[model samples]
Target chain A: MNRTITVRPGLRDIPQGRLGMWLLIAGELVIFGAAVVSYLLMRIRYPEWGEQAQYTSTALGALNTFVLLTSSFFVVKAHKASLAKDSKNVVRFLSLTLLCGLIFLIVKGIEYSTEISHGFTLRSPGLVDSGQGVASLFWMYYYLMTGLHGLHVLAGMIAIFVVMLQVRKGKYFHRVELAGMYWHMVDLIWIFLFPLLYILK
Target chain B: MNIAHHEMSFWRRYIFSTDHKVIGFQYLITGLIMAAIGGYLAYVFRYNLAFPAESIPLFGSLGPKEYNAFITSHGAIMIFWVAMPLLLAALGNLLIPTMIGTDDMAFPTLNMLSYWFFFLSAIVLLLSFFVPSGPFDGGWTLYPPLSADAYINTEPDIWKSFMTGGTLIILALALEFVSMLMGGINFLVTTINKRAKGMTLLKMPIVVWFINFAVIDFMFSVGPIIAGAFMLLLDRVAGTGFFDAYRGGDPVLFQHMFWFFGHPEVYVLLFPSLGVIAEVISTFSRKALFGYKFIIKASLIAIVLSVVVWAHHQFIAGIDPRMATFFSIGTILISIPFAGIMLSYIATLWGGNIQLKVPMMWALGFIAIFLVGGLTGLYLGSDTFDIYVHDTSFVVAHFHYTLFPITFFGFFAAFYYWFPKFTGRMYNTVLAKIHFWFTFIFFQGFAFPIFFLGLDGQHRRINDYSAFDSLMSSWHISFRQFATISAIILILSQFIFLFNLLKSLRSGKKSEENPWKANTLEWQTTSPPPHGNFVKYPQVYRDPYDYGNPDMKEDYLPQNKVI
Candidate 1:
């Protein structure tokens, strides 16, 4: 009885909605690619502006990285549990993943507020090599990249919540696994972003 | 294959429809109406051009500011509102669905939203004309400094209208892009996963694959533009200094963003409708598209090339010389794929049972015009040549060749091909051909000399060119004469199309379910298709182009049936 009902098609079969998500993701990856490319070029042109890097707090970013990585573990467990017809564990592990997502967003909000109070506004001035002042390009990129990532976290949380509701209703159970994969991909992006923004000199 | 899950309603079926066919027609209708407004604006401005600040015989003598207003509004409406919408939104709507076997789009509600937003955009655009500052006069590009200060002394502060309208257009294009993306996924997934069982990727019709590629093209290309729109809107209202140079921003940045979308917007307008023309001629003539596989491979190559070549438009914008040369060469390289597709179409017509139908003739006309249009494109892309022709009548001439001929002519070709499927009745061959020739000859008159004038270094957008050497001045005078005559002829050509559509609804001969014997799944359904589309799901076995094969009894294979 347990073996008869699996939520998703075996590896060969891809649900329509899941494939749509992947296609949509490919488009998204290019957009992020561009903004990231712009950031890389701008950063390379100006090297000594590592002062902004000191304030970005590698410890918090590393902590958030661990939280996101750990959340993926719970999401994978939830997917496997859903396939095994263990709805109880599915609910438990998914809730944990969702909690981690909320924590990540909350921490990001705190970081943004702290940076603003420190007078690191997007258009704030910084000293160049000769004591000439220029608007902070690094900070502009900081707000653009991190701010966009923050929005993605909010979106991911919503997607996870929808998956929970769907699992409750016993509808589109196959979709949860795919959604989890996508959520992990979003988390994976931040993993790179964290090291680049916070960990790097 | 399970269409039971995909049924829709009457309001949802046609009017306010999400059906790509309906949406395509809606886009077509909206584009032509905009064209008429835009086209007339050009005529009014031409009179202003021939006799500066003088009242013309018709529509009253124009004022200087009105010329400024007319020139700005006309260029914006024609290029963005008419050309882009007609070719991409209208034609892409109709063809993407039919070429693939999908019953309807993936998200029907979203599809409807796309057209309505386009409608809102057109309204916003027209509304600006009536406002004080008398609509933006800073040309359609709407460069900063000229558009910067609020009317020191001008009617409706129309720059705000430009801002509001331009944003709506971007939103509409975004909506179009999203719905099309969903439709593309459906096409790709259905082609791969739900291909009526027997249809293989190679077996899919050439047109099916073209639209599939178009979906991917718009998806990747549109994002930068979407971000650009937001920034422009921010600059417009939010006091953001994104493009406001005096406010510590870069004006050229706006050009970078606009052209990023603007340049690929050409392919967005070109490829899908060309796909339709490709399908129409091959099927009607009882032949497979020549080099079908290479055309497919070449188009994908084209999509990749389009993304990188956008900087070609900015060669003169003071970029690094090294980067400029690289982009210029890339822009020229992009033409290679276009050459491949054109050669394939011409070869498809070879050694076939050529149908001399109105649609076939229009398709041939498209080939001729597009060839010239495309080949001359080489000039605009080369850095050395571009320096001479940039912003001149020659560049304008080159585009009008490609755009009007393909977009209008190719769309008409599609109209005659599928008007039966859409309306369940045949169009009058006499009227369609009549409309075709008048517009075709007039199009020649309109575009051909404008090329020569461009060679003469005749600049565009001037209110008067009467003082130049007569040889150079002749280009403007001749331009004035031929352009106005062609404009009126093209505008009148629409009536024949409209009359045929309206009359054919009740009066024309009823068509069989699949009159053209097309291989695609749209033909598997009834003439207009049913509410759920089909009672029995179609299973595919043979390719969409099984025509003239000795192994097959019928000339064409239904995409659903086994060989």
Candidate 2:
């Protein structure tokens, strides 16, 4: 009978979920990497972009970077806690990770409103007639890159939340680490985004 | 591996099924239905193109606006809906698990989710046709500035509408990409970590390897386009300047992003079909695959090279001269590995006892047709020649030559080859052969004259060729007439296949477990294999293609056969 068989764990001796996450990371890098490369190329061609970059508040960018890094650290802690089978610590670190994500989005939201109040908007032909081509292009990249990064942050938080739910339900604790790995990727993209969009000049 | 078999209700068994086979059939049926829609759209436009003033039977006269919508949706539906679903999703899902000796996909829930995503996206796409702006008419490329702003479409109806067709198209396609992404992850994870005992990477059938290559290629290449689609959606809805030229955004960036995924996307579609051809050729030739290692290496080389050649499509779109030349060279280089694969298939056929069965005929037909397609692609790959053939029927003909054989011929081959094994019944051979000849002849007749019309300066995407400003020669009209006739016949011939498929399901000759006497792991299980595929875990002992082995008593040695 077909019931007389049992598949060995890891047919190739590699954890399938971890491998899937890594493959996803590579794909995400290519996506975000391509966008960043486009930004860098545009900046290189248009040198006035550096002057435009200086107008943005570097303090907020650096603060978000610190926030993301802290989240990554906590997610790592959650992964370690899960591996050590400490349910309480896993929940604790994951909650911290989720908190950091909220803070990052709130700060990003504040920055966006401030920039809009300063008349740096993404709405259409006004950007071209603003008489600063490089600045317009700079804000376009800033919003697109940061906006995409923020979406990633949101996705990461939801994933961390789900993993936390699973942990609380007392099942599938290994998913905590896999979800953390994805969270770290979100953090890593922001690390690049911080330098390129905010401080590169 | 032994998996516990559970008796499930009809909803769980079929509707929300996780069985790879059931999902494969779901994709097949859905793709066929969509293909009919795409094919009908072709007929509508072709009729209008041929006789611009005349009204058709059921549908009334189609205006230029309607024509544009038809052509655009036709391209999108045929590729995304029909071809991907039929060739990749269906065949890959159905065959990968059985051929690789697995119980089910690594992530069964994710597999189910992929199909549901596809279903939801298809529903959205269908609904877009009924929307106020009508479906997107920006061509399948969805090049921006025009695609970005509804006001730029020049259609009287769309101009007044804010909720444009392009947004709906983008949303539907984004969902489709997500579905494909999920399926890709499953394929990769399953193949990498779920192979049977003693079935190492190299020991896998060429089809499994091809699926692996195609899935990974999809995972790597599809990201940029996904990002681009999101950006384009934002540009349309939120007034972002990603591809809006008035806002200092470069439209060419969208083209780069689209084709970056676009070119590799064709290979992603082609590899699985080619994999099917490899299996069919080896099986019918009664020979081990010639240069199996070489084919794998060539596929990998082609996969790597496919990405760099994306800019060839952009040569006429105002790219740098140096970059154009580089892309032209890169495009030309892709044909080398393909030629190697082609030659290897021919080598497999050399000095072998060949069976001209329905599947074999289709496989051999794939080689003959794809050769023409590949050669003509070389013509279009040159930057100089592309200047003349750009947007012409010659380009259209060349594209049909490339894609039609894969989607039609390869799909039919897979259908016929695996029919008995999956359906547990044999189709009428005579009917199948008739279906093949009619399809092959009519499709060629349909595609070939379009090439001449293209070379004669007949442009594509125009609603009416009879307009005074048209650059078409007088002879081009007759060619169009001929093409129209051929297409009708080609479409009509499909009924024979449909009849054969439906008839074979219940009343045709019942199939044995190994009716074809092939040497694959799938043949070891019962036809229409049970819930848990194998009665005993199959331990692989030899290569899948062991045809005509001198030491073997029988002509073939199954992969799990014990000495």
Candidate 3:
């Protein structure tokens, strides 16, 4: 890629698209940071929230973490393939990454259904009725944090699928790295979500 | 400059155009229209407050609910819909590329999308007023308990909740924040990546630097509030307990989250207005900006201090005393940096060929009026003093003094400053000056009396003062009547500005390329620059404010001139 050096010397070495992506990542991180910080503050106030953590299915959380980690590796490989101008390998690794996103979402869907069927929904009826009203807040935060993460996974899958299609047509290879970077952010957020929600108990 | 261009249809060129200037104009007009709506809302509420149940001329009698909704919408619309769109989005889109000597924004399509998103959010907010329930009446801050109590005792249904005013307003705000985030990214990237050959960072205009800081401040501060808004919406719709104290949630947590974004949000508005004042002061004074670098550094320090002073707004909202003390000190400390910046502006005006143009008049009005607002703020910033005067009309007067000048005064200064470039025609200076004086005098007449009334222990957000016999003294009644009359005249005076704008667009004299003979890169281009902006791309040599240089033949030097 040909790069035109602008008068600002410091950022000229960074591609404009990559720089834009990094700034966007910074914004998204702060957003998630708010949720994380709020949760940690509330968790300290109510240690019994760890009791609600027992219901989060640690085994499934671990499996999804592995799946997301593998997807991150696949996206990095796709970035490498795009650097080499190998569109075929780029498509291959991107599709693998998309597949992992799909598996992670499926696992999350199953866990959500199991929790709901077991009367552990966002507005859990049993907790509210038992006069431990604050405990229901734990379930609310649990669903909110994981549910927001699940939406990101779905968005990442769509993004990866689009990039894969464009790569298949031998166009816009640089978007592969942008898509990879976004996927890493998604993966990184889940890494935080996992220990906080599932393993803390 | 030699690039060939093709003609496009009207829809592509104006409505869906990716050009920054056209998009800027779109935001400008939209914001002005929203300002009209907000102003009308203010008139209705002010009329009710003064007359106490007397029917208004244009609108009928105002009820308590209607009065609450009007004040709430007026505050929300002015800040979110008017000030932000006009100052940050409109001015940022217009000036960043032009002043930096670039053809367009780095991401033009995203820039276009940002305006459309803002347009959509404006529509949503307007539609919110006509919902079954009136618009959100829990104040512009959207404090919980009041905001979250929409359907407290009933079973929550998604569709039912969606139609309510509170939920719709939150949705509108979320959309607005998304739009601004997109616009912020575009501003940051464009200013960083696209500049002329010799236009280094320091050589860029102060307005561009201030816009960048405002955008950065916005991006960092708005996140927690976005998260908080989501939680508040869930509390309304999904039977969730994110901010309901009765349902295991703490409302104070919402206050912390809201003010976390709210206080910096003031700077997000102030910084750009200050930037406009800097440009206007330097130009009209025919002097180089005094302490230009110092002003920028001081504003940076002020931005940092702004983030830590959010809790000052919450001293009487049940925060810890120690935390309030820390916040009070922080809030008082913040005034120093701002004072330094203001002093620099005054210093820039010291001993030079000062021209009292319409724009310069507005700029001077801003510094004088905003000082009153800023100094009054220190009293409220202290925890001890705030406990007595919290939620009084004094706070109301303080903010209106600050915000009215920042938004409207700053806007008129910018609008008149760039009118020629915007339309390629000179405005009627006599009518413009008349408009400015009417606005300035009446604004002070309207907002200044409230300080005395608030000192007399008159509370805000009360529709009818008849219920409180103590608040309805002859002295209080006269002040209300005087302020309301002044506000009415203040709202009506805007028509003169509109008339001036219309007259200029139709039959005014053609403006020269550099009417002011100033030294910004934007003036180096034609009045109403062409599609590619410049016949030849400019190469900058010096800083934006090089007025009255000793070695120069002319009093001012343009940035692009190769001296």
Candidate 4:
């Protein structure tokens, strides 16, 4: 009864963090995917949504998308550096990714303000009169999708901030890759959200 | 690996323990407490329906809104707070790590966090009852328009109460979902990465495999509902038009999203209990489980098909006609996998050395009761038949027949079966059997007549049939009294269980390592195995059930025993 046994790992054997993160990714995709399907379903019924799409600032949206894509590159670099045990580069790249998240948030804030300033709001007073019936739905999805994605971005930044501090203490460096993967997920969601919200029309 | 070697403070050892078993009991105790609360709510509502003119003691008076609150809270609490935790969280946590020969979960701290979040969710649910608006009365499904309009244009204080209470229920559900998500990750990772030497996937117990399948299904299924909940929350609090038809938001969209999660949630509850019955029956019958591979395939089929059948719940909600037909056929098709599983259980029991232990009685009871439940499902699954029984007592009876056996009988079977191993004490067998008979008979007596009332077209969620003279037939009133009496008797029988459980814990015969001589890894270790579980890591040599093997001298052969 005192004997200790070792299990043989199969082909898919991997770290818990990577496995858990991938499963989390699958669940997230469904959530975002549900919203996407809803948008497409409603869009088919109401072709007039093209008018509501005009209220969004495509330039700002494109800028934020570029920021997220670049940040994802930094996240990949961070994962590579952490695998090499280069704690400095892990912290540096993670900091850069977090910075990109902040920049995207700033650009998003500008786009939202610009839209709201023109009275293109979630509760705009004259939605029924103007017959933006379908267009209002487009904006509704735009705000909800982007807003949810933004929360994910904020979560990613907080995760990286903690990982950065741990890396600075020269311990728990494995967390850097995990945090980077999460940040990349945020970027991945934005990659889907950008064109659907800003450029689909 | 010696768990007893290390000593810790009381707080660290129990209060904030990270041990899987501790967390398992935490889930169990909390779920039971919530069950009691939910049951009391049922008692109150049943009494109201039974004696409409009379005011019950302790809970003096019941208004229409108050009656709605009781029903809403009862459904939500029982399913989310009680059944989910009891089956998935409690049994799943206690068994998976020990059975798979893992010292702890892949992430034990995350496991602990899951329990605390569940605790927080329970507290939030209880708090909703105390709120000024007295919990959301829009029913457990929380169909929108009612749910959406709950927060609008009431008196300022009352409006605030509704807003707070509604949001709390939604937030509590969200938290529970996340908690289960964390638990699901641990289950998947542990099963995939942490099995003992030679414990191949198929060689594992059916209970472990079913739980693994269940967690994965739950992971994918819960997503859309969480999204829908957020949209509903926005509609309620933020004035977003997600479900507000006045703002061009179709409430039916919410139905699609909700049932997308809701229908699969039934399987999430069903699979684990099915797994439990399989183990109990095989172990008692002294034979290998029949159709082991087929059972696995059947579970997988059920999982895949569950997602497509959700619209069956929304058939009469003004959904597209083509969509209704598609969902109807899809729902009917799901019966095939369930039939396969049920048939496998009966086949397992055929021509075997039978032992009618308390656990086995409950297992056989589950099959008998669930068969009625499953057959009634076919009736409701057919679109034409469903149009007649849609919101009637028939639907309620059918649902209880399906869920009651799985949740109550299933959990009780597991409880009696595993009590010896975890507690290192054998319960009073006579008392256990008595509890079973009372529970089974009364449960049937309670739910069976609801079918007749439903056929009479008595709508559900009504506080009192006596109040509705137009809809009330003599049969409806009489059956209400009968069902209510059966329910009271059914609830009282649970006291026999509680008394037996507590009395046995204090004074009972000590148990051996393998009290029932079952051939599984958890039984191979000492009764109440140490924190690291096994003194030596178990290496499996055969499938879990090798009962009455001709080559073996004993009636059962443990998995770790080399042939």
What is candidate 2's DockQ?
A: 0.47
Question: Each candidate's chain B TM-score?
Answer: 0.88, 0.97, 0.98, 0.97
TM-score of chain A of 1: 0.86
lDDT tens readout by residue for model 1, B1-563: 34652576667666787566677678778888888788788778765664565677668978767787788888778766786666656655565455455555555665677677677767767766655556667666655544433212122243454444444443444544554555455545544454444556787766656666766677777666555554554344433344544333456655665677677777876776688788887987788878888888888888888888887777777767798899888898988888888888888888888878888888888888888999898998998888888888898789888888767887788778878886778888899899889888888876787788788888776666655665445546767667666766766677887888889877999888888887887777777766435556567666676677777888777767654
All candidates: TM-score: 0.86, 0.95, 0.98, 0.96
lDDT of 3 by residue, B464-535 (tens): 988899998898999999999999999999999999988999998999998988899888888888876877
DockQ of each: 0.23, 0.47, 0.68, 0.49
> Between prediction 1 and prediction 2, which has the larger DockQ?
2
What lDDT does the true structure give each of the candidates? 0.70, 0.86, 0.90, 0.86
lDDT of 4 by residue, B182-290 (tens): 8988888888888898899989999999988889889998888888888877666666677767656788998998889998888888888998999999999998999
Which runs of model 4 end up more than 4 angstroms from their true locations?
A1-12, A126-134, B1-6, B150-163
- Model 1 CAPRI rating: acceptable
Clashes of 3: 0
lDDT of 3 by residue, A1-201 (tens): 999876865864577788788888888888888988999999999998888899889999999999999999999999999999899999999999988998998999999999998888877878888887788899889988888888888888898899899999999999999989999999999999999999999
- Give a tens-digit lDDT track for model 2, residues B312-422: 888899999899999999999999999999999999999778989999999988889999999999888999999999999998999899899999899999999999888
Question: Which candidate ranks first by TM-score, i.e. highest?
Answer: 3
2 against 3, candidate with superior DockQ? 3
Shift in Å, residue B561, candidate 1: 5.4
Q: What CAPRI-style quality would you assign to candidate 2?
A: acceptable
Clash counts per candidate, in order, are 11, 2, 0, 1
What lDDT is obtained when candidate 1 is compared to the true structure? 0.70
